[model samples]
Target: MLPAVAVAAVAAVAVAVAVAVPALRHRLVRSALRRAGGRYRRRLEALSSDVRLNQERRLRRLLRAGTGTGTGTAGGWEEFQQRHPLGQPCREEAPEDAVPPLWLWALLPGCWDCDPRLQGSLLYLDALGTAFPRALSRRGTALLHWTPGCPRAPAGWPLPTLYCTPAAAGTVPSRAAALRLQLLFALRQRELHVLEAGLAAELHDALVALRTEWPQLARELALGRLSPQPGLPEEVQRQLQALLAPDAARAAELRAECARGFEGILQRLWPQLEVVVVRMVHGSERLYCNSLLQAECQGLPFYCPFYQAAGALLGVNLWPAEPEPRFLLCPDWAFCEFLPCLANKEPQTVLLDELWEGREYRLVVTAQPGEYRCRTGEVLKVTGFHKQCPVVEPVRRESQTLSVRGEDIPEEQFCQSLCRTLRTWPGARLIDYACVESSLLGDFSGPCAPHYEVFMELQGLRDLSEGQRYKLDQCLQEDFPIYKSFRFKGSIGPLRLHLVRPGTFTRLREALGSPRPMPRVLHQEQLLQLVQGSIIS
Candidate 1:
C-alpha cells in the first residue's frame, strides 16, 4: 500500500511540472520576440506615414493658398523628409482655424557662430513683438533653424526674405537687414503700430527740429525738388542740402553751431549707435568705403560732425578725414564717395617742417569726405577740383613719470596713491589706466625693481608743449625720486610714462600731503629736458 501511494504521488508531481514548464516557456518566447522587434519601430512607422500624409496635405494647401499653382512637386518627399526626417508628427493644436492666419513668414537660414551684435539685434526684434503685437502675430512668424548646420527652405520663406551669410549673421549687416525687413514688412502690412507712439513722437520731434533749423532745405525736400541729388529721397536730399548748402558763409556758421550741438547730443547717444553701425557694414563697412575713396583722396574727410559726435558717444574714435581747403560745390554722389575714403586713412600724420605752422597744407594724401578738419577756423587749400587739403596743426609732445617701489605694494594702496597723483597733474589726466602683475617685474628680484609695474596713460592734451613735458617730468621726479629712469611708449599722439623702480611709500605720502581748494596745476614750463653732454659724443 505504501509503494502504491509513493508511485501515485510521483506521477502527480510529474504531471504538474509538464503543464507549468510549457506555459512558462511560451510566455518567455513571446517577451523575447517583443524585445527584439524594437520598442518604437511600429509606433515610429505609423508616425512617419501620418507625417508624410500631413506634409502632402500641407503642400497642397500651400499651393492652393497661392494665387498661382506651384510649378511642380518634384523632390517633394525629399524636401519634406529634410524638414522633418525623424518622422515626428507635429502636435495637432486645435484645428488650423483656431490659430490666426499667418500673413508673413520670417525665414532665417542657419545662424551658427553668429556675432554677438546680431544676437542682440534679434533680441531687440523679439522685444518689438511685445510693443507691436500685430507686427509679429500669426501674420509674421520668425523662423530660425532648429538644428545646427541646416539650411532653411527658400520656397516656404516669406516674400522679401532676408538671406544673410553665416559670416554676416549676428553682425551689423544682419541687424540692418533685419531693421530694413521689419520696416518694409510694416509698410507692406500697413502695421504702423510697430512704430510705437513714443518712438513716433521722438522721430517726429527730430524731423521737426531738422526742418525748423533748415527751412529752405526742408521746403526743397517737401517740394520734391532735387537740391543735391534727384535719386535721393526728398527727406535725405533736404538733410544733404542743409549739410552742404551752396552758400559757403551761411553753411560754415550753421555747421559750426550744428557741430557743437551735435557733439553734445552724440556724447549721450553714441553708445547705442556704435554697435548699430558696426553690425550694418559687417567689419567691412569702413573698409569698403575706404577702398571706394582711395582714388580720390588718400583718406576720408571729416565732413559729418554729427556722425563723429555719435562715434564719440559710443566711446570710439571716428575715422579722421581730410580737410577741405576752399569750399567747392560738388555733386551729392561725390560727397557720398568722400565719406568712406576718410574713414580708412591713418589718423596720425608726421609733421614735416614745410607743412608745420603753414596756413594751408596737404594731407599725407587725398582725404575722405567728412573726415579731415582743421582745428578751430583752420582752412585746407584745394590744389585741384577734387583735391583735399587738411590743415596740419603743430605736433605737441607731453610727458609724465610714475614711480614704483622695488617691492610690490598692496593693490589698494598703490591704486589710491596713483589716483591721487594723477588728479594733481594737469597734462596727465588719467584716461583709463590699470595695474596688472608683470612677469618681467615679478621675475626681477633686484632691490630696486618691484614685483609689479604700474602703467599710466594720458589723453586729451591741451597742447603738446615743452613746458607741459617739463612739468610732468618734475612732478614724477619730485614724487618718487627713487625711480629716476622713465620709459615712454604708445601709439597715436598720447604719452605713456613708466617709472622703472619701486616707489618709496614715504615719498608717495609727501606727494599726497594736504588737500587744497584746487589741485596744483602742472605747467608746461616746469619740465626739465635731459641734455646730451660732450663726453657722450
Candidate 2:
C-alpha cells in the first residue's frame, strides 16, 4: 500500500513540472539576453570615455600647430570667433567659388590624404579604420553593393558592380534591372547579409519597385544556393547569367543556396537582416535616423558622411558599439560658427562652443593654414553633446534658399512643402527636382512678380492639375509665414510646378558636367530647355 502511494505522488509531480516548462522557457531566455546586452554596452561605454575627453584639447593643439600662430588657436570658443570673421564666396560667382580652394593646395600640410585643411575627411576615415576590423571580418564584409550597369571586366575592389542601360532606358527600367542584379547576389552566400547603395533614396526606390511589381522575385532573393529551376525568368535571366557564373565566381566564389532574405519582407517579418550600407542620406530629411525608410522595413544602416574619397570619412554612426546608428555629428576636427545674417554680403560669424547644444550654425572650416575660415554655407544643427563634442547634423545649405522676394525658403522647408503636396497627389514618387528663380527667366515685367519655378522628375505620375499645383503653394504658405506675407503683399507670384520629361535630370547632370552642380537656385537660361518647354497651357 505504501509503494502504491509513492508511485501516484511521483506522477503528480511530473505533470506539474511539464506544465511549468512551457511558461518559464521564454521568460528565462529573455532575462539572460537582457543581462548579456547590458554588460556589453557598459564595457563599450568605458572604452569610448577616454577618447571623448581628449577630442577638444587635441583639436586645438592641431589647429595651433597647423596655423603656426599661438594666438590663433588660443582663447575660449567665443574668443576664437572674434578673431576670424566669416568668409563667403561672391554671390555673382555662384558655383565657381563653391569649387575646392585648389589655389591653396600647395600650402596645406599632411599630404593630400592627411591634410589639416581636409580635417573632415581625416577624422571620418580614422573612425572607420578603427571600427572596420572590429565590426567586420577580413574574410568578407558581406557587402552587397549595387551598380547602375554590369562591368565588362570583373571588379576586384568593392567588387566590380555591373549594371548597364536597362534593356529599356528610363529611370524605372534602370532601377528594375539593378534590382534583379541585387536579387541574383542575394541568391549566393547564404550567411552573407548587408545590401549597400550610394544613396538611401535609390535603395528605397529599388526595393519598393520590386515589391510592388515583381514580388515573385522574393523566392530568388532568398539566402540560398542556386536551385534546380525549370528555367530562369526571361526578364532577368541574362543579367543573372552574366553575374553568377558558377564555380565560386571570382572572390572565393561564395556559392550557397541562400533563400531567405526578402521572403518575409513583404509578407510577415524580417528579423535576420543585418544592416544596409548607405553612403549618405539626401537633404529631403534632416536627420539620418528619420530619413532611412528602408531601415524601417527591417534593416540596420551603416551611415557615412557624403564624401567617397579614401580616408575622407566623417560623421559617426558606429554600428555595433551603439545599438542603433546615432548618425550624430560632433566632429573633433574643425569648429562651426553661426552666420549672423545670410542675406548680407558681409555677415559676421561666431564660433559655437564645442560643448554647446541645440543651436544651428554655418560650418566655418579652418582650411589651408594660411587661408581664411571657409564659410562652407553648410548649416548644421547641434542636437546634443556627447561629452565635450557637440552632436550635430547637416541642416541645409545656405545656397538652397529661394529668396527672390525676401521670403527665404530653405531646402528643408521647401522639401516639407513638397512632401505635403506628394501625399495628396496620388501615385507620384520623386526622382529629382531643381528650383529655378522666376527672375532667371527674365519675365520681371509680366503680370506677376518674381516667384519660384520648380522642375521635377517623378515616377508613376503623368498628369498634374492646377489645384494640385496650388496645393504646394498652400503648403508653403502654411509652413513659412514670410512666404505667405509676400504672397499677401503681391511681392511674389504663385509658385509654378513643371513636370519634366523622363531622364530630364540625368541629361541635366550630364550637361552641367562633373564637380560643379550649380546650386539649387539655378540661373543658367540655356539649362532651362526641358524645364520651360514642359509648361502646360
What's the residue-level lDDT of 231 in candidate 2? 24
Specify the poorest-scoring 10-residue window by lDDT in model 1.
528-537
* Candidate 2 ranges with C-alpha deviation above 4 Å: 1-84, 89-135, 138-191, 201-273, 285-314, 319-332, 339-355, 427-431, 443-447, 506-527, 530-537
Model 1: number of backbone collisions:
52
Writing each residue's lDDT as its tens digit, candidate 1 over 322-357 gives 232122211110111111112356333322211222
What lDDT does the true structure give each of the candidates?
Answer: 0.26, 0.49
lDDT of 2 by residue, 86-107 (tens): 5554232222111133233422
- For candidate 2, what is the lDDT? 0.49
TM-score of 1: 0.21
